[model samples]
Target: IVLAPVSLAAEDPLPSWRDGPGKAAIVEFVARVTRQDSAGYVEPHERIATFDNDGTLWSEQPLYFQAYYALDRIRDMAADHPEWKEREPYRSALAGDVKGLAAQGKGPVVEMLVAAHANVTTEAFTRSVAHWLATARHPRTGRLFTEMVYQPMLELLEYLRANDFKVFIVSGGGIDFIRVFSHERYGVPPEQVVGTTGGARFELRDGIPVVVKTGDISLIDDKAGKPVGIWRHIGRRPIFAAGNSDGDLQMLQYTTVARNEDDTTPRLGLIVHHTDGEREFEYDRESAVGRLDRALDMAPEQGWLVVDMKRDWRRVFPVAGS
Candidate 1:
Protein backbone atom coordinates (compact mmCIF):
# COMPACT_ATOMS: atom_id res chain seq x y z
CA ILE A 1 0.00 0.00 0.00
CA VAL A 2 1.25 3.47 -0.93
CA LEU A 3 1.15 5.52 2.26
CA ALA A 4 0.62 9.25 1.90
CA PRO A 5 3.36 11.57 3.05
CA VAL A 6 2.71 12.94 6.54
CA SER A 7 1.10 16.39 6.32
CA LEU A 8 2.35 19.08 8.72
CA ALA A 9 0.34 21.97 7.31
CA ALA A 10 -1.17 24.34 9.88
CA GLU A 11 -4.72 23.16 9.28
CA ASP A 12 -4.87 21.34 12.68
CA PRO A 13 -5.47 17.87 11.27
CA LEU A 14 -7.10 16.99 14.56
CA PRO A 15 -9.89 19.59 14.60
CA SER A 16 -11.24 17.53 17.47
CA TRP A 17 -8.22 18.27 19.75
CA ARG A 18 -10.12 21.28 21.19
CA ASP A 19 -9.36 25.02 21.09
CA GLY A 20 -8.43 25.73 24.70
CA PRO A 21 -5.95 24.15 27.12
CA GLY A 22 -5.92 20.65 25.65
CA LYS A 23 -5.37 22.03 22.18
CA ALA A 24 -2.89 24.64 23.37
CA ALA A 25 -0.73 22.07 25.12
CA ILE A 26 -0.47 19.89 22.02
CA VAL A 27 0.27 22.88 19.82
CA GLU A 28 2.93 24.11 22.23
CA PHE A 29 4.53 20.69 22.40
CA VAL A 30 4.72 20.52 18.61
CA ALA A 31 6.10 24.04 18.40
CA ARG A 32 8.78 23.19 20.93
CA VAL A 33 9.85 20.18 18.91
CA THR A 34 10.13 22.23 15.71
CA ARG A 35 12.04 25.21 17.23
CA GLN A 36 15.76 24.67 16.89
CA ASP A 37 16.56 26.85 19.91
CA SER A 38 13.82 25.42 22.15
CA ALA A 39 14.67 23.07 25.02
CA GLY A 40 12.27 20.56 23.46
CA TYR A 41 13.89 20.45 20.05
CA VAL A 42 13.69 16.72 19.41
CA GLU A 43 15.01 15.12 16.27
CA PRO A 44 12.30 13.42 14.24
CA HIS A 45 13.64 9.98 15.06
CA GLU A 46 13.30 10.59 18.80
CA ARG A 47 9.79 12.07 18.59
CA ILE A 48 7.85 9.06 19.84
CA ALA A 49 4.29 9.33 21.16
CA THR A 50 2.29 6.51 22.71
CA PHE A 51 -1.50 6.22 22.89
CA ASP A 52 -3.78 3.85 24.78
CA ASN A 53 -6.12 2.14 22.42
CA ASP A 54 -9.52 1.44 23.95
CA GLY A 55 -10.57 4.25 26.26
CA THR A 56 -7.77 6.45 25.04
CA LEU A 57 -8.40 6.36 21.31
CA TRP A 58 -11.99 5.13 21.38
CA SER A 59 -14.76 4.04 23.76
CA GLU A 60 -14.02 0.96 25.88
CA GLN A 61 -17.41 0.74 27.45
CA PRO A 62 -19.80 -0.70 28.33
CA LEU A 63 -16.87 -3.11 28.54
CA TYR A 64 -13.56 -3.46 26.77
CA PHE A 65 -14.98 -3.94 23.24
CA GLN A 66 -12.22 -6.43 22.58
CA ALA A 67 -13.52 -8.50 25.49
CA TYR A 68 -16.90 -8.49 23.86
CA TYR A 69 -15.30 -9.79 20.68
CA ALA A 70 -13.58 -12.48 22.69
CA LEU A 71 -16.88 -13.39 24.31
CA ASP A 72 -18.55 -13.62 20.95
CA ARG A 73 -15.74 -15.74 19.64
CA ILE A 74 -15.97 -17.91 22.73
CA ARG A 75 -19.68 -18.44 22.18
CA ASP A 76 -19.07 -19.38 18.56
CA MET A 77 -16.30 -21.77 19.51
CA ALA A 78 -18.25 -23.22 22.45
CA ALA A 79 -20.28 -25.36 20.09
CA ASP A 80 -17.25 -27.58 19.84
CA HIS A 81 -16.52 -27.42 23.56
CA PRO A 82 -19.77 -28.00 25.39
CA GLU A 83 -17.83 -27.85 28.65
CA TRP A 84 -17.74 -24.08 28.20
CA LYS A 85 -21.45 -24.00 28.96
CA GLU A 86 -20.56 -24.78 32.55
CA ARG A 87 -17.36 -22.74 32.61
CA GLU A 88 -17.39 -19.73 34.90
CA PRO A 89 -16.93 -16.63 32.77
CA TYR A 90 -17.78 -18.18 29.47
CA ARG A 91 -21.07 -19.39 30.89
CA SER A 92 -21.83 -15.97 32.29
CA ALA A 93 -20.74 -14.26 29.07
CA LEU A 94 -22.81 -16.57 26.89
CA ALA A 95 -25.79 -16.00 29.15
CA GLY A 96 -25.61 -12.28 28.29
CA ASP A 97 -24.84 -11.30 31.85
CA VAL A 98 -21.85 -9.02 31.49
CA LYS A 99 -22.31 -7.53 34.93
CA GLY A 100 -22.08 -11.01 36.40
CA LEU A 101 -19.11 -11.83 34.30
CA ALA A 102 -17.33 -8.66 35.31
CA ALA A 103 -18.16 -9.26 38.95
CA GLN A 104 -15.62 -12.03 38.61
CA GLY A 105 -13.23 -9.23 37.69
CA LYS A 106 -9.92 -9.43 35.83
CA GLY A 107 -9.34 -13.10 36.57
CA PRO A 108 -12.47 -14.21 34.77
CA VAL A 109 -11.69 -11.80 31.98
CA VAL A 110 -8.25 -13.36 31.69
CA GLU A 111 -9.74 -16.81 31.59
CA MET A 112 -12.10 -15.81 28.84
CA LEU A 113 -9.22 -14.23 26.98
CA VAL A 114 -7.08 -17.35 27.19
CA ALA A 115 -9.95 -19.55 26.16
CA ALA A 116 -10.87 -17.46 23.17
CA HIS A 117 -7.61 -15.92 22.03
CA ALA A 118 -5.17 -18.74 22.72
CA ASN A 119 -4.60 -21.76 20.52
CA VAL A 120 -5.09 -19.74 17.36
CA THR A 121 -2.22 -19.09 14.98
CA THR A 122 -1.27 -15.45 14.53
CA GLU A 123 -2.53 -15.56 10.95
CA ALA A 124 -5.77 -17.22 12.00
CA PHE A 125 -6.30 -14.74 14.81
CA THR A 126 -5.69 -11.83 12.46
CA ARG A 127 -8.14 -13.30 9.99
CA SER A 128 -10.70 -13.70 12.76
CA VAL A 129 -10.31 -10.08 13.82
CA ALA A 130 -10.64 -8.88 10.23
CA HIS A 131 -13.75 -10.98 9.75
CA TRP A 132 -15.37 -9.87 13.00
CA LEU A 133 -14.66 -6.19 12.47
CA ALA A 134 -15.98 -6.34 8.94
CA THR A 135 -19.29 -7.80 10.13
CA ALA A 136 -19.85 -6.90 13.79
CA ARG A 137 -21.65 -3.72 14.84
CA HIS A 138 -21.20 -2.12 18.24
CA PRO A 139 -24.18 -2.92 20.44
CA ARG A 140 -24.97 0.69 21.31
CA THR A 141 -23.72 2.61 18.25
CA GLY A 142 -24.77 0.02 15.64
CA ARG A 143 -21.66 1.00 13.69
CA LEU A 144 -18.88 -1.23 12.53
CA PHE A 145 -16.23 -1.73 15.23
CA THR A 146 -13.76 0.33 13.23
CA GLU A 147 -16.37 3.08 12.82
CA MET A 148 -16.57 3.39 16.59
CA VAL A 149 -13.06 4.96 16.69
CA TYR A 150 -13.03 8.55 17.93
CA GLN A 151 -12.73 11.17 15.20
CA PRO A 152 -10.78 13.49 17.48
CA MET A 153 -8.30 10.81 18.50
CA LEU A 154 -7.89 9.74 14.89
CA GLU A 155 -7.12 13.37 14.05
CA LEU A 156 -4.69 13.58 16.96
CA LEU A 157 -2.88 10.55 15.53
CA GLU A 158 -2.57 12.21 12.14
CA TYR A 159 -1.56 15.47 13.76
CA LEU A 160 1.26 13.82 15.69
CA ARG A 161 2.48 12.00 12.62
CA ALA A 162 2.47 15.27 10.70
CA ASN A 163 4.78 16.74 13.35
CA ASP A 164 7.28 13.93 12.73
CA PHE A 165 6.13 12.00 15.79
CA LYS A 166 6.39 8.25 15.52
CA VAL A 167 2.96 7.26 16.82
CA PHE A 168 2.22 3.86 18.39
CA ILE A 169 -0.84 2.23 19.89
CA VAL A 170 0.16 1.17 23.41
CA SER A 171 -3.20 -0.34 24.16
CA GLY A 172 -4.48 -3.10 26.42
CA GLY A 173 -6.33 -4.55 23.47
CA GLY A 174 -4.75 -7.53 21.76
CA ILE A 175 -1.80 -6.41 19.62
CA ASP A 176 -3.00 -8.61 16.83
CA PHE A 177 -6.53 -7.26 17.16
CA ILE A 178 -5.56 -3.59 16.73
CA ARG A 179 -2.79 -4.38 14.23
CA VAL A 180 -5.35 -5.76 11.76
CA PHE A 181 -6.80 -2.29 11.11
CA SER A 182 -4.47 0.19 12.84
CA HIS A 183 -2.84 1.01 9.51
CA GLU A 184 -6.07 1.57 7.62
CA ARG A 185 -7.95 3.28 10.44
CA TYR A 186 -5.29 5.18 12.40
CA GLY A 187 -2.40 5.13 9.89
CA VAL A 188 -0.15 3.50 12.53
CA PRO A 189 1.28 0.48 10.85
CA PRO A 190 1.18 -3.04 12.37
CA GLU A 191 4.73 -2.74 13.68
CA GLN A 192 3.77 0.42 15.54
CA VAL A 193 1.08 -1.29 17.66
CA VAL A 194 1.98 -2.59 21.13
CA GLY A 195 -0.57 -4.48 23.18
CA THR A 196 -1.28 -7.65 25.14
CA THR A 197 0.05 -10.57 23.15
CA GLY A 198 -0.64 -14.27 23.25
CA GLY A 199 2.32 -16.60 22.82
CA ALA A 200 2.90 -18.22 19.47
CA ARG A 201 5.47 -20.58 18.01
CA PHE A 202 7.32 -20.88 14.73
CA GLU A 203 5.91 -23.68 12.66
CA LEU A 204 7.06 -24.89 9.28
CA ARG A 205 3.65 -25.49 7.75
CA ASP A 206 5.07 -25.42 4.22
CA GLY A 207 8.76 -24.83 4.97
CA ILE A 208 7.99 -21.41 6.42
CA PRO A 209 8.65 -20.46 10.07
CA VAL A 210 5.38 -18.64 10.32
CA VAL A 211 4.06 -17.95 13.83
CA VAL A 212 1.76 -20.77 14.80
CA LYS A 213 -0.87 -21.32 17.46
CA THR A 214 0.05 -21.65 21.14
CA GLY A 215 -1.80 -21.97 24.44
CA ASP A 216 0.43 -19.54 26.25
CA ILE A 217 -0.93 -16.23 27.62
CA SER A 218 1.63 -13.51 27.86
CA LEU A 219 1.49 -9.97 29.26
CA ILE A 220 -1.73 -8.01 29.45
CA ASP A 221 -1.23 -4.32 28.61
CA ASP A 222 -3.24 -2.43 31.20
CA LYS A 223 -2.93 -0.46 34.43
CA ALA A 224 0.58 -0.82 35.89
CA GLY A 225 1.29 -3.35 33.20
CA LYS A 226 1.16 -0.53 30.67
CA PRO A 227 4.59 0.71 31.66
CA VAL A 228 5.97 -2.82 31.71
CA GLY A 229 4.61 -3.46 28.24
CA ILE A 230 6.09 -0.20 26.97
CA TRP A 231 9.51 -0.98 28.40
CA ARG A 232 9.57 -4.50 27.06
CA HIS A 233 8.01 -3.80 23.66
CA ILE A 234 8.82 -0.27 22.47
CA GLY A 235 12.05 0.00 24.46
CA ARG A 236 11.77 3.81 24.27
CA ARG A 237 10.00 6.14 26.65
CA PRO A 238 7.37 8.26 24.91
CA ILE A 239 7.56 12.03 25.14
CA PHE A 240 3.82 12.37 24.58
CA ALA A 241 1.01 10.22 25.93
CA ALA A 242 -2.81 10.30 25.89
CA GLY A 243 -5.42 8.14 27.54
CA ASN A 244 -8.95 8.33 29.01
CA SER A 245 -9.02 6.11 32.08
CA ASP A 246 -7.27 5.10 35.28
CA GLY A 247 -6.03 2.12 33.33
CA ASP A 248 -4.01 4.61 31.30
CA LEU A 249 -2.65 6.67 34.19
CA GLN A 250 0.52 4.61 34.54
CA MET A 251 1.20 4.91 30.82
CA LEU A 252 0.81 8.68 30.92
CA GLN A 253 2.94 8.83 34.03
CA TYR A 254 5.62 6.68 32.46
CA THR A 255 5.81 9.06 29.52
CA THR A 256 5.76 12.29 31.52
CA VAL A 257 8.42 11.29 34.05
CA ALA A 258 11.57 13.36 33.43
CA ARG A 259 14.02 11.67 31.15
CA ASN A 260 17.84 11.86 31.51
CA GLU A 261 18.56 11.53 27.82
CA ASP A 262 19.75 14.80 26.21
CA ASP A 263 17.81 14.30 22.99
CA THR A 264 14.44 13.48 24.66
CA THR A 265 11.92 16.23 25.15
CA PRO A 266 9.92 16.78 28.30
CA ARG A 267 6.69 14.83 27.95
CA LEU A 268 3.12 15.96 27.36
CA GLY A 269 0.30 14.05 29.05
CA LEU A 270 -3.39 14.47 28.17
CA ILE A 271 -6.35 12.61 29.56
CA VAL A 272 -9.64 12.23 27.72
CA HIS A 273 -12.55 12.58 30.11
CA HIS A 274 -15.72 10.93 28.88
CA THR A 275 -18.20 13.52 30.09
CA ASP A 276 -20.78 13.07 27.34
CA GLY A 277 -23.33 10.42 28.09
CA GLU A 278 -25.61 11.86 25.43
CA ARG A 279 -23.12 10.93 22.74
CA GLU A 280 -21.40 8.24 24.81
CA PHE A 281 -21.50 6.80 28.31
CA GLU A 282 -20.01 9.23 30.86
CA TYR A 283 -19.49 7.65 34.27
CA ASP A 284 -15.98 8.33 35.40
CA ARG A 285 -16.36 7.85 39.13
CA GLU A 286 -18.21 4.55 38.82
CA SER A 287 -17.52 2.86 35.51
CA ALA A 288 -15.72 -0.45 35.91
CA VAL A 289 -14.01 -0.92 32.57
CA GLY A 290 -12.48 2.53 31.97
CA ARG A 291 -12.49 3.89 35.51
CA LEU A 292 -11.21 7.48 35.75
CA ASP A 293 -11.31 8.09 39.51
CA ARG A 294 -7.62 8.50 40.34
CA ALA A 295 -6.77 10.27 37.11
CA LEU A 296 -9.48 12.86 37.81
CA ASP A 297 -8.24 13.56 41.33
CA MET A 298 -4.57 13.87 40.36
CA ALA A 299 -4.99 15.81 37.11
CA PRO A 300 -4.42 19.16 38.78
CA GLU A 301 -1.53 17.98 40.94
CA GLN A 302 0.15 16.22 38.03
CA GLY A 303 -0.38 19.22 35.76
CA TRP A 304 -2.01 16.94 33.27
CA LEU A 305 -4.51 18.42 30.88
CA VAL A 306 -7.89 16.78 31.21
CA VAL A 307 -10.11 16.93 28.13
CA ASP A 308 -13.81 16.96 28.91
CA MET A 309 -15.13 15.25 25.85
CA LYS A 310 -18.52 16.89 26.00
CA ARG A 311 -16.95 20.34 25.97
CA ASP A 312 -13.74 19.70 24.06
CA TRP A 313 -14.77 17.52 21.15
CA ARG A 314 -16.89 19.27 18.53
CA ARG A 315 -17.53 16.00 16.81
CA VAL A 316 -17.46 12.57 18.43
CA PHE A 317 -17.51 9.67 16.02
CA PRO A 318 -16.36 10.23 12.47
CA VAL A 319 -19.07 11.13 10.01
CA ALA A 320 -20.39 8.26 7.95
CA GLY A 321 -17.98 7.31 5.13
CA SER A 322 -15.33 9.69 6.46
Candidate 2:
Protein backbone atom coordinates (compact mmCIF):
# COMPACT_ATOMS: atom_id res chain seq x y z
CA ILE A 1 0.00 0.00 0.00
CA VAL A 2 1.22 3.47 -0.92
CA LEU A 3 1.06 6.13 1.81
CA ALA A 4 -0.29 9.48 0.67
CA PRO A 5 1.80 12.50 1.55
CA VAL A 6 0.10 15.36 3.38
CA SER A 7 -0.12 18.75 1.68
CA LEU A 8 1.32 21.37 4.01
CA ALA A 9 0.06 24.11 1.70
CA ALA A 10 -3.53 23.15 2.40
CA GLU A 11 -3.17 23.51 6.15
CA ASP A 12 -4.70 26.67 7.66
CA PRO A 13 -2.62 28.60 10.18
CA LEU A 14 -5.73 29.64 12.11
CA PRO A 15 -8.40 27.08 11.33
CA SER A 16 -10.70 27.96 14.21
CA TRP A 17 -10.85 31.63 13.12
CA ARG A 18 -13.59 32.37 10.67
CA ASP A 19 -12.61 34.20 7.48
CA GLY A 20 -13.54 37.82 8.18
CA PRO A 21 -12.09 41.31 8.68
CA GLY A 22 -10.64 40.42 12.09
CA LYS A 23 -8.90 37.26 10.90
CA ALA A 24 -7.76 38.92 7.71
CA ALA A 25 -6.26 41.83 9.64
CA ILE A 26 -4.31 39.45 11.87
CA VAL A 27 -3.02 37.45 8.92
CA GLU A 28 -2.04 40.54 6.99
CA PHE A 29 -0.24 42.11 9.94
CA VAL A 30 1.74 38.92 10.56
CA ALA A 31 2.69 38.65 6.91
CA ARG A 32 3.73 42.27 6.75
CA VAL A 33 6.05 42.01 9.73
CA THR A 34 7.48 38.60 8.81
CA ARG A 35 8.29 39.31 5.20
CA GLN A 36 11.83 40.77 5.06
CA ASP A 37 11.12 42.65 1.87
CA SER A 38 8.00 44.28 3.26
CA ALA A 39 8.36 47.83 4.57
CA GLY A 40 6.67 46.77 7.82
CA TYR A 41 9.11 43.90 8.42
CA VAL A 42 10.32 43.53 11.99
CA GLU A 43 13.39 41.71 13.26
CA PRO A 44 12.79 38.16 14.51
CA HIS A 45 13.79 38.99 18.10
CA GLU A 46 11.46 41.99 18.11
CA ARG A 47 8.53 39.87 16.96
CA ILE A 48 7.28 39.60 20.53
CA ALA A 49 3.61 38.99 21.21
CA THR A 50 1.82 39.16 24.55
CA PHE A 51 -1.65 38.12 25.72
CA ASP A 52 -3.91 38.66 28.70
CA ASN A 53 -5.15 35.40 30.23
CA ASP A 54 -8.61 35.79 31.75
CA GLY A 55 -11.36 36.74 29.33
CA THR A 56 -8.90 37.17 26.47
CA LEU A 57 -7.70 33.59 26.31
CA TRP A 58 -10.29 31.82 28.38
CA SER A 59 -13.70 32.11 30.02
CA GLU A 60 -13.48 34.48 33.01
CA GLN A 61 -17.20 34.75 33.65
CA PRO A 62 -18.84 34.00 37.00
CA LEU A 63 -15.48 34.84 38.54
CA TYR A 64 -11.78 34.55 37.83
CA PHE A 65 -10.54 30.95 38.03
CA GLN A 66 -7.65 31.79 40.35
CA ALA A 67 -10.12 33.48 42.70
CA TYR A 68 -12.02 30.21 42.85
CA TYR A 69 -8.80 28.34 43.56
CA ALA A 70 -7.91 30.78 46.33
CA LEU A 71 -11.40 30.50 47.81
CA ASP A 72 -11.21 26.73 47.69
CA ARG A 73 -7.84 26.81 49.44
CA ILE A 74 -9.28 29.08 52.13
CA ARG A 75 -12.18 26.66 52.63
CA ASP A 76 -9.84 23.64 52.82
CA MET A 77 -7.71 25.36 55.46
CA ALA A 78 -10.68 26.58 57.49
CA ALA A 79 -10.53 23.66 59.90
CA ASP A 80 -7.08 24.70 61.16
CA HIS A 81 -8.27 28.21 62.12
CA PRO A 82 -11.42 28.11 64.17
CA GLU A 83 -11.18 31.88 64.74
CA TRP A 84 -11.93 32.29 61.05
CA LYS A 85 -15.49 31.28 61.85
CA GLU A 86 -15.94 34.66 63.56
CA ARG A 87 -13.74 36.76 61.29
CA GLU A 88 -15.21 39.16 58.77
CA PRO A 89 -13.76 37.81 55.48
CA TYR A 90 -13.12 34.22 56.52
CA ARG A 91 -16.61 33.88 57.92
CA SER A 92 -18.09 35.13 54.67
CA ALA A 93 -15.64 33.06 52.65
CA LEU A 94 -16.33 29.95 54.72
CA ALA A 95 -20.00 30.47 54.12
CA GLY A 96 -19.33 30.97 50.37
CA ASP A 97 -20.59 34.53 50.44
CA VAL A 98 -18.78 36.16 47.51
CA LYS A 99 -20.70 39.41 47.74
CA GLY A 100 -20.12 39.68 51.47
CA LEU A 101 -16.42 38.99 51.06
CA ALA A 102 -16.21 41.68 48.35
CA ALA A 103 -18.06 44.15 50.54
CA GLN A 104 -15.42 43.72 53.27
CA GLY A 105 -12.78 45.30 50.95
CA LYS A 106 -9.36 44.64 49.36
CA GLY A 107 -7.79 44.27 52.80
CA PRO A 108 -9.80 41.16 53.55
CA VAL A 109 -9.23 39.79 50.08
CA VAL A 110 -5.47 40.32 50.41
CA GLU A 111 -5.51 38.74 53.85
CA MET A 112 -7.33 35.72 52.50
CA LEU A 113 -4.97 35.48 49.52
CA VAL A 114 -1.85 35.74 51.65
CA ALA A 115 -3.19 33.23 54.14
CA ALA A 116 -4.11 30.79 51.43
CA HIS A 117 -1.07 31.32 49.19
CA ALA A 118 1.81 32.23 51.50
CA ASN A 119 3.70 30.56 54.38
CA VAL A 120 4.37 27.56 52.16
CA THR A 121 7.07 26.34 49.81
CA THR A 122 6.57 27.42 46.18
CA GLU A 123 6.73 23.80 45.08
CA ALA A 124 3.90 22.77 47.41
CA PHE A 125 1.74 25.65 46.23
CA THR A 126 2.35 24.62 42.63
CA ARG A 127 1.37 21.05 43.45
CA SER A 128 -1.81 22.23 45.15
CA VAL A 129 -2.76 24.36 42.14
CA ALA A 130 -2.06 21.46 39.80
CA HIS A 131 -4.27 19.20 41.89
CA TRP A 132 -7.10 21.73 41.88
CA LEU A 133 -6.84 22.27 38.13
CA ALA A 134 -6.99 18.54 37.61
CA THR A 135 -9.97 17.77 39.86
CA ALA A 136 -11.90 21.02 40.28
CA ARG A 137 -14.51 21.99 37.73
CA HIS A 138 -15.87 25.41 36.81
CA PRO A 139 -19.01 26.17 38.86
CA ARG A 140 -20.94 26.93 35.70
CA THR A 141 -19.24 25.04 32.84
CA GLY A 142 -18.48 21.81 34.71
CA ARG A 143 -15.16 21.88 32.83
CA LEU A 144 -11.74 21.95 34.44
CA PHE A 145 -10.27 25.48 34.72
CA THR A 146 -7.47 24.60 32.32
CA GLU A 147 -10.03 23.16 29.88
CA MET A 148 -11.80 26.53 29.79
CA VAL A 149 -9.02 28.03 27.64
CA TYR A 150 -10.33 29.28 24.32
CA GLN A 151 -9.72 27.15 21.20
CA PRO A 152 -9.29 30.19 18.94
CA MET A 153 -6.73 31.81 21.21
CA LEU A 154 -4.80 28.53 21.51
CA GLU A 155 -4.58 28.40 17.74
CA LEU A 156 -3.52 32.07 17.67
CA LEU A 157 -0.70 31.36 20.16
CA GLU A 158 0.56 28.45 18.06
CA TYR A 159 0.24 30.48 14.90
CA LEU A 160 2.29 33.34 16.32
CA ARG A 161 5.03 30.94 17.50
CA ALA A 162 5.09 29.29 14.09
CA ASN A 163 5.73 32.69 12.51
CA ASP A 164 8.78 33.29 14.72
CA PHE A 165 6.89 35.41 17.22
CA LYS A 166 7.83 34.87 20.85
CA VAL A 167 4.54 34.77 22.75
CA PHE A 168 4.21 35.75 26.41
CA ILE A 169 1.20 35.67 28.71
CA VAL A 170 0.86 39.02 30.55
CA SER A 171 -1.98 38.47 32.95
CA GLY A 172 -3.34 40.28 36.00
CA GLY A 173 -3.75 36.90 37.69
CA GLY A 174 -1.19 35.41 40.05
CA ILE A 175 2.16 34.73 38.36
CA ASP A 176 2.77 31.46 40.20
CA PHE A 177 -0.81 30.35 39.66
CA ILE A 178 -0.71 30.95 35.89
CA ARG A 179 2.79 29.45 35.55
CA VAL A 180 1.57 26.05 36.78
CA PHE A 181 -0.45 25.41 33.62
CA SER A 182 0.74 28.00 31.04
CA HIS A 183 3.12 25.60 29.34
CA GLU A 184 0.87 22.54 29.26
CA ARG A 185 -2.21 24.53 28.29
CA TYR A 186 -0.88 27.38 26.08
CA GLY A 187 2.55 26.21 24.86
CA VAL A 188 4.01 29.24 26.69
CA PRO A 189 6.65 28.26 29.22
CA PRO A 190 6.62 29.52 32.83
CA GLU A 191 9.36 32.09 32.21
CA GLN A 192 7.29 33.59 29.39
CA VAL A 193 4.43 34.42 31.76
CA VAL A 194 4.14 37.87 33.42
CA GLY A 195 1.49 38.40 36.08
CA THR A 196 0.86 39.73 39.59
CA THR A 197 3.42 38.36 42.04
CA GLY A 198 3.80 37.88 45.76
CA GLY A 199 7.18 38.07 47.49
CA ALA A 200 9.29 35.00 48.26
CA ARG A 201 12.61 34.23 49.88
CA PHE A 202 15.08 31.34 49.85
CA GLU A 203 14.89 29.35 53.07
CA LEU A 204 15.90 26.06 54.67
CA ARG A 205 12.92 23.89 55.45
CA ASP A 206 13.52 20.44 56.93
CA GLY A 207 17.25 20.98 56.11
CA ILE A 208 16.37 21.35 52.43
CA PRO A 209 16.57 24.58 50.44
CA VAL A 210 13.13 25.84 49.39
CA VAL A 211 11.57 29.09 48.33
CA VAL A 212 8.93 30.22 50.79
CA LYS A 213 6.16 32.51 49.61
CA THR A 214 5.78 35.66 51.69
CA GLY A 215 2.67 37.70 52.24
CA ASP A 216 4.22 40.77 50.59
CA ILE A 217 3.21 41.48 47.02
CA SER A 218 5.99 42.33 44.57
CA LEU A 219 3.89 43.49 41.64
CA ILE A 220 0.34 43.95 40.41
CA ASP A 221 0.50 43.40 36.63
CA ASP A 222 -2.68 45.00 35.38
CA LYS A 223 -3.84 48.18 33.60
CA ALA A 224 -0.91 50.61 33.98
CA GLY A 225 1.20 47.91 35.57
CA LYS A 226 0.94 45.79 32.42
CA PRO A 227 3.35 48.03 30.52
CA VAL A 228 5.72 48.17 33.49
CA GLY A 229 5.67 44.38 33.83
CA ILE A 230 6.44 43.97 30.14
CA TRP A 231 9.28 46.44 30.46
CA ARG A 232 10.78 44.85 33.57
CA HIS A 233 10.20 41.19 32.73
CA ILE A 234 10.19 40.98 28.92
CA GLY A 235 12.39 44.02 28.23
CA ARG A 236 10.81 44.41 24.81
CA ARG A 237 7.66 45.95 23.46
CA PRO A 238 5.42 43.28 22.00
CA ILE A 239 4.80 43.85 18.30
CA PHE A 240 1.50 42.01 18.69
CA ALA A 241 -0.82 41.88 21.70
CA ALA A 242 -4.28 40.45 22.43
CA GLY A 243 -6.68 41.12 25.27
CA ASN A 244 -10.38 41.48 26.06
CA SER A 245 -11.07 44.17 28.65
CA ASP A 246 -10.28 47.58 30.12
CA GLY A 247 -7.62 45.92 32.27
CA ASP A 248 -5.69 45.37 29.03
CA LEU A 249 -6.11 48.84 27.53
CA GLN A 250 -2.62 49.99 28.43
CA MET A 251 -1.11 46.78 27.11
CA LEU A 252 -2.81 47.26 23.77
CA GLN A 253 -1.72 50.88 23.63
CA TYR A 254 1.87 50.00 24.48
CA THR A 255 2.08 47.35 21.78
CA THR A 256 0.55 49.09 18.76
CA VAL A 257 0.42 52.86 19.34
CA ALA A 258 3.55 54.53 18.03
CA ARG A 259 5.64 56.65 20.38
CA ASN A 260 6.26 59.06 17.50
CA GLU A 261 6.12 59.14 13.71
CA ASP A 262 9.82 58.17 13.58
CA ASP A 263 9.25 54.87 15.44
CA THR A 264 6.98 53.05 12.99
CA THR A 265 7.45 49.40 13.75
CA PRO A 266 4.60 47.22 12.61
CA ARG A 267 2.22 46.29 15.43
CA LEU A 268 -1.14 44.58 15.89
CA GLY A 269 -3.52 44.90 18.81
CA LEU A 270 -6.36 42.39 19.07
CA ILE A 271 -9.42 42.56 21.27
CA VAL A 272 -11.52 39.46 21.84
CA HIS A 273 -15.05 40.85 22.12
CA HIS A 274 -17.32 38.40 23.91
CA THR A 275 -20.40 38.63 21.73
CA ASP A 276 -21.40 35.00 21.80
CA GLY A 277 -23.42 34.23 24.91
CA GLU A 278 -24.83 31.10 23.30
CA ARG A 279 -21.34 29.67 22.74
CA GLU A 280 -19.35 31.31 25.55
CA PHE A 281 -20.42 34.77 26.79
CA GLU A 282 -21.71 38.16 25.71
CA TYR A 283 -20.49 41.14 27.68
CA ASP A 284 -18.83 44.53 27.63
CA ARG A 285 -19.01 47.96 29.48
CA GLU A 286 -21.45 47.01 32.24
CA SER A 287 -20.17 43.57 33.36
CA ALA A 288 -17.91 43.51 36.38
CA VAL A 289 -15.65 40.66 35.36
CA GLY A 290 -13.40 41.46 32.40
CA ARG A 291 -15.24 44.68 31.65
CA LEU A 292 -14.62 45.94 28.10
CA ASP A 293 -15.37 49.66 28.24
CA ARG A 294 -12.39 51.95 27.60
CA ALA A 295 -10.58 49.52 25.33
CA LEU A 296 -13.65 48.90 23.21
CA ASP A 297 -14.14 52.63 22.90
CA MET A 298 -10.52 53.17 21.84
CA ALA A 299 -10.15 50.30 19.35
CA PRO A 300 -11.13 52.33 16.29
CA GLU A 301 -8.78 55.16 17.16
CA GLN A 302 -5.95 52.75 18.00
CA GLY A 303 -6.54 50.67 14.89
CA TRP A 304 -6.85 47.59 17.05
CA LEU A 305 -8.71 44.66 15.58
CA VAL A 306 -11.72 43.70 17.65
CA VAL A 307 -12.69 40.08 17.15
CA ASP A 308 -16.38 39.54 17.73
CA MET A 309 -16.42 36.04 19.21
CA LYS A 310 -19.81 35.26 17.77
CA ARG A 311 -18.85 36.29 14.24
CA ASP A 312 -15.13 35.60 14.03
CA TRP A 313 -14.79 32.25 15.73
CA ARG A 314 -15.99 29.05 14.11
CA ARG A 315 -15.14 27.18 17.29
CA VAL A 316 -15.24 28.62 20.80
CA PHE A 317 -13.65 25.63 22.53
CA PRO A 318 -11.98 22.31 21.93
CA VAL A 319 -14.52 19.51 21.72
CA ALA A 320 -14.55 16.47 24.05
CA GLY A 321 -11.57 14.85 22.28
CA SER A 322 -10.19 17.51 19.93
The prediction achieving the highest TM-score against the true structure is 2
Model 1 TM-score, 2 decimals = 0.91
lDDT of 2 by residue, 196-311 (tens): 88899999988999999998888788899899999989998999999998989999999988889898888899999999999887888887677899999999988999999999
TM-scores of the candidates are 0.91, 0.93
lDDT (CA) per prediction: 0.80, 0.86
Residue pairs with clashing backbones, model 1: none
What lDDT tens digits, residue by residue, belong to model 1 across residues 54-128? Answer: 877777777777777778887778778888778787888888787776565543575466556555678888898
Task: Give the range where candidate 1 is weakest over 10 consecutive residues by summed lDDT.
Answer: 102-111
lDDT of 2 at 286: 82
